[model samples]
Target: MGRKKIELKKIECPKEKSSKYSKRKKGLLKKAEEMAVLCDSDIILLVFSPTSKPNLFYPHSRPLGRILERLSNMSEYEREERRSYTKKV
Candidate 1:
């Protein structure tokens, strides 16, 4: 069950923003854990709050740095390919 849709803009009230952040953060982490358990796969979730605080979760027994590096390299390669294709066209 999800909450009703709301605008993405910042909440003016500090208390309300804090409450919302806590709830959503917990919900996301729970979902991540559930997916990892159900699929038997590696899952890394990194979230940054408005205050720049980071929350990291690793469901599998893998190093966080290694996974981030691999994902970064993959995205870079894809970006380069896309650039080359656009230049040729």
Candidate 2:
């Protein structure tokens, strides 16, 4: 048995939109946590709802900004080069 499929478009009803967002957000965070634990990774996940509510998850040992700062160290050109290389493979 498989789950029912829903269209990829935006949900038209406000209540349904909010409900779906809440469910998906929790699921995403849960998966990220599982990945971090199983892989022994440092993860930082952040989600902002359409209503501007912020939800975040990260390793307890480090501040979130430090992880973001590591990403910032890569120049835009360097990032683009890596992206293009991956596409070729």
How well does model 1 score by local distance difference test?
0.83
After superposing candidate 2 on the true structure, give the runs of residues whose Cα lies further than 4 Å from its correct spot: 61-66, 72-78, 81-89
TM-score of each: 0.60, 0.68
Model number with the top TM-score: 2
> How does model 1 score by TM-score?
0.60
lDDT, candidate 1, 1-89, per-residue tens: 99999768868887888889999999999998898888866779889986789988987556778767766777777979978999999
Residue-by-residue lDDT tens digits, candidate 2, 1-89: 99999769988898999999999988898888788778977788878987898888886766778878877898999989988999999
Clashes of each: 0, 0
Candidate 2 TM-score, true structure as reference:
0.68
